[model samples]
Target: MSRTILEVTDLRKDYRQRRGLVSMLTGQGRVIPAVDGVSFYLRENETVGLVGESGCGKTTIGRTVLRLTDASSGRIVFDGRDITTLSRAELRPLRREMQMIFQDLDAGLNPEMRVRDILREALTVHERPSDAEIAGRVRELLEQVSLKDSKLANFPSELSGGEKRRVGIARVLAVRPRLIVADEPTSALDISIQAQVVNLLRDLQKNLGLTYLFISHDLPVVELVSQKVAVMYLGRIVEMGLAERIAHQPRHPYTGILWSSLADKQTTEVTRRVTNVAVERERRTWGVFDFEQPTSGCRFAPRCPLYKEKGRPAICTDPASEPQLRDVGHGHVVACHFA
Candidate 1:
C-alpha cells in the first residue's frame, strides 16, 4: 500500500464576523465555522476529490491543509510530520514539497515579468541554481507542462487564458512539489481547453507521482480524477467513499442530491434515475440560513430530503444528536443518522 502523504484530523477554521463599529469595538462577532471538524487523508501519488456547492469550504480545506491559512483547531500532518504549529521559518523548507494551483488563471503570473523570468524566480526560491542549471530546468519545466519555448518571452498580459494557466502550472512545477492543492484548476477554461488541461494534469500525475487534493464542483471531472470522493455540505463532509460507490450507491441523501444535480445538466439515463431517486422527496424550499446561528443538530437538516421523508425525526433536530461520521462498509463513511 502507498504511504499516507497527508492526514488532517478534525480540522476547523473559523472566521469572525462583526456587524457594526459598535460590535467591532466591543469585540463581539459571530464565529462562522468555515471548515467544521473535517478529517481525511491522501495516499502517495493518489488524488482525493473534495466536492461541494460554493461556500461549502472546499477551498478553505485545501488552503488550510497546505498551511496557506491557519486552522482554528485540529492537526495537519504532512509526510508523517505534524505541521499544524510550525513557524514560518520552519515551514520555509517544507514549502518546496507542497504548492497550490489557484482558481485564477493569472494567480501567480506576474504581469510585469515574462514567463521565463517568472519560472526562474520560482526555481531559485529555495536554491541558488547556476545560470546553466536554471536554463536546463526551465526547458525541462516547459516540456513537462507542454508549453512552447517561444512563448517564454511573452508577459502574462500577452498570453491567452490557456497559456496563462499553463504558465501558472509550470511555475508550480519549477519547485518540484510532490503534493498539489488544485483549486478549481479547470473551472475558468473553455470546454475544449478544460479537457486539455484535465488530460495534462492526469498525465503529469502519472509521470511525476504527484498527490493532489482536487477541489471542484464539476462532479464528472472529480469522479474522473479522484480515487476517493468526499461530499461536503455546510462545511462538513456528509459522505465519502470510493468514487464509483459514491456516484452509484450513495448512502447519504446529500451525496445523492449532489450527483443528481449534475444529472440535471446532462441527460444521461443513469443520471436520470439517480435524479428521480434523490430529488423525488426534495420538496422543501432551500432557505438561506445564517452560519453564525447554526441549526441545533445536523447543519444540512434544513435542506435534507431524508429528514422530511422520515417524518421530521426529533433525533435529527436534537441538539445533542448531531450525526458524526461512521464507517458503513468497504471504507465508506457517512454522517447521517439513518444512513
Candidate 2:
C-alpha cells in the first residue's frame, strides 16, 4: 500500500463577517465556518477529489491544508509531520515540497516578468542554484509542462489563456513539489483546451509521482482523476467513498441529488436515476442556508428528499441527534440518519 502523504483531522476554518457599521464598531462579527470539521487523507501519488457546489468550502479546505490560510481548529499533518502550528520560518522549508495551483490562469505569473524569469524565481526560492543549473532546470520545466522554449520570452499578458495556465503549472513544477492542491485547474479553460490540460496533468502525475488534492465542481472529471471522492455540502463532507461507488451508488440524498442534477443538465430532460417529482419539488423549494445561521441537526435536512419522504422524522431535525459519518462497507462513509 502507498503511504499516506497528507492527513487532515477535523479541520475547521472560520471567517468572521461584520455586516453593518455598528458590528464593525463593536469589534463583533458572526463566525462563518467555511470548512467545518473536514477530515480526509491522501496517499502517496494518489488523487483525492473534493467536489461540491460553489461556496461549499472546497477552496478553503485546499488552502487550509497547504497552510496558505490558517485553520481555526484541527490538525493538518503533511508527510507525517504536524504542521498546523508551525511558524512561518519553520514552514518555509516545507513549502517547496507542497504547492498550490490556483484557479486563476495568471495566479503565480508576474505580469512584469517574462515566463523565464518567473520560473527562475520559483527555482531559486528555497535554494540558490548556480546560473547554469537554473538555466538547465528552466529548460527541463518547460519540457515537462510541454511548453515551447520560444514562449519563455513572452510576458504573462502576451500569452493565451492556455499558455498562461501552462506557465503557472511550470512555475509550480520548478520547485519539484510532491503534493499539489489543484484548485479548479480546468474550469477557466475553453472546452478543447480543458482536455489538453487535463491530459497534461495526468501525464505529469504519472511521470513525477505527484499527489493531488483535486478540487472541482466537474463531477465527471473528478471521477476520472480521483481514486476517492468526498462530497461536501454546507462546509461538511456528507459522503465519501471510492470514486465509482460515490458516482453510481451514492447513499446520501445530497449525493444522489447532485449526480441526478448533473444528468438532467447533460441530457436536458428529467433524470430518472436518483430524482423524481418529489425530489425536484423539494429542490425547487429548498431555502438557502449558510454557516452563520446553521439549522439544527443535519444541515442538509431542510433540502433532503429523504427527510420529506420519511414524513419529516423528528430525529433528522433533533439538535442532539445530528448524523455523523459512519462506515457503511468497503470504506464508504455517509452522514445520514437513514442511509
Candidate 3:
C-alpha cells in the first residue's frame, strides 16, 4: 500500500505592511492573514486537491509547503521529516525529493538556455554529472514529458502553452522528485489542453508513485484526480473529505453553494433549510470538517442559510461545531454544525 508522504499542521502565514515610520515604531502595521492554522496530508500515489476562490490563500499553502517561500508559522512534515524548521542547506539536499510544477511563473523563461541547460541546472544543483551525461539525461527527461531533444534548443517563445508546461514538467522530472506540488497547472490553458496536462501528471504519478498536492480553483478537475479534497475560504479549510463526497454532498454552506452552483442547482428557488440535507447526513457518518474552520464558531454564517443568530463573535460569527470526520458508512467526511 502507498504510505503517507506529507503531513501538515497548524500552518499559518501572515503578511504585515508598515504604515509609516511612526506606525512601524508603534508596532501598528496592519496584518493580512493569508493562511491560518491549516492542516492536511498527502500520500504516495495520492492526490489531494485544494479548491477555493482566488485570494483565499490556496496558493500560499502550496508554496509554503514546498518552502518556495518562508511560512509565518506551522509545521510541514514531508517524506517522514519535519521541513518546517529545516535550514536552507538542509532543504537543498531534500530538493531531490521535492519539486513544483508551476503554472504561470515559468512561462517567461530565458530565450537563451537550451532545454539541456535548464534541466542541467537542476542536475548541477544536487549532483555532479558530466557534460555528456547531462545532455543524455536532458533528452530522456524531455521524452518523459513527451518533448523532443531538438526542442531543447528552442526558447519558451517557440513552444505552445501546453508544450511550455510540459517542459516545466520535464524540468522537475530531471531532479527525480518524489513529491510534486502542482499549483494551478491547468488554469491558464484551454480546457482541451488542461486535460492533456492533467492526464500527463496522472500518468507520471502512476508510473513513478509520486505524491501530488494539486491546488486549483477548478472544482471538476479536482474531483477527477483527487482522492481527498480540502475546500478553503478566507484562509481556512472550511470542509474536507473524499472528492466525490465533498463535491456532490457538501456540508459546509459555502461548499454546498459552490457544489450546488457547479451541479446547476444554485437557483435556490426553494432555499433548502438546507437544500443538501441528504448530503449532510451522509457526511455525518464520516464526520469530515470536525474542527472549527476559525477558532471562532462559524466563518461562513454571513453566507449560510441554516445559520442561527447567536451572541459574541465567538458565538455569533462562529460556525458550527460538531460532526467530526466520523465514518458515516462510506469514506466521506463533512464539517458543519448540522452535518
Candidate 4:
C-alpha cells in the first residue's frame, strides 16, 4: 500500500443547540452529531469520494479534517502527525500541507481582489517570497490550472463560472498542499462546466501527485474521480470500500438504493444485477431521524428498506451492540446487521 496522506479515526463533531425559555426550564436541548465516528484513510495520490444525502455530514467531515471547525473528539493524522488537538499557532506552519476547494467558487474568492492578487496572497501568507518569485509563482499557478494571463486582472465576478473554479484550484495550488478536502467542487456548475472542472482536477492530481477527499452527492462525478467510495447516512458511514465494488456490488441497502436512483442506463442495470432487490415503489421517506444523538444500534435501521422488507426485525433495530464496520471481502466493509 502507498503512504497514507490522511487518516481520520473515530472522528466526531457535534453541535449543541440552545434551548428556548420553556425548553431551558424543562432542561430540553439537542446535540446534533454533524460528523459521528467517521473513520477513513486516503493514500498518497488517491481520491476518496464521500457520497450521501444533503444533510448527511459530508461537508462537516471535510471542514473538520482541516480544523476549520473544531472536532468534538477523535484524531486527525495528516502526513503521520497527530494534529487533532494542535493549537492554531502549532497548526499555522502545517496549513500549507492541506487546503480546501469550496463548492461556491466566487464565494471563496475575495471579490475586492484581482485573480493574481488572490493567488499571490496565498503564496505570500505562508512565507516571505520576493515580489519576483510571487509573480512567477502566480503565473505558474494559472498555467497549472489552464487559465490564461488575461484572467490575472479579472475580479471573481468578471470571470466565467468555470474560470472562477479554475482560479480556486490555482489558489490551492499556490500553497502546494498535499491533500485537498474538496467539498462539492463541481456542485454549482452546469453539466458541461462540471465535467471541465472534474477533468481539470483530475489532471492536476495526476501531474502534482495530490491526494483528495472528494466530497459530493453527484454519484457519476464521484464514480469518475474516486478510487474508493464511502456512503454515509445520518452522520455515519454505513458502507465503504473500493469504488468498483461499491458501484457494481454494493452490499449495504442504502448504497444499492442510491445507485439504483441514477438515471444512467448502464448504472441502473449494474445496480439491479448486484442488488437483486428492485427499487421500492411509493418512494416515501424511508425512515425518520430524530434531532438528538441516537442512543445506539444501527443509525440507518429506521430508514432501511431491507429492515422494512424483513418485517422490521428486532436484530436490526436493537442490535446486541452498535454495528461496527466489518469486512465482507476484498476490503469492502459495511456497518449493518444484514449487509
lDDT by residue (219-265, candidate 4, tens digit) is: 87898899999999888998999998898788888888787767434
Q: What overall lDDT, based on C-alpha atoms, would model 4 receive against the true structure?
A: 0.86
How does model 2 score by TM-score?
A: 0.94
Clashing pairs in 2: none
Best by TM-score: 1
List candidate 2 segments past 4 Å from native. Answer: 19-28, 267-277, 288-292
CA lDDT for candidate 2: 0.91
Give the Å shift of residue 141 in candidate 1.
0.7
lDDT of each: 0.91, 0.91, 0.76, 0.86
Q: How many clashing pairs in candidate 2?
A: 0
RMSD to truth, every model: 2.0, 2.1, 6.3, 2.4
Residue 4, candidate 1: alpha-carbon lDDT:
98
**TM-score, predicted candidate 1 vs. hidden true structure:** 0.95
Write one digit per residue (lDDT tens) for candidate 1, span 149-259.
Answer: 999999999998888889999999999999999999999999999999999999999999999999999999999999999999878999999998998898998888878
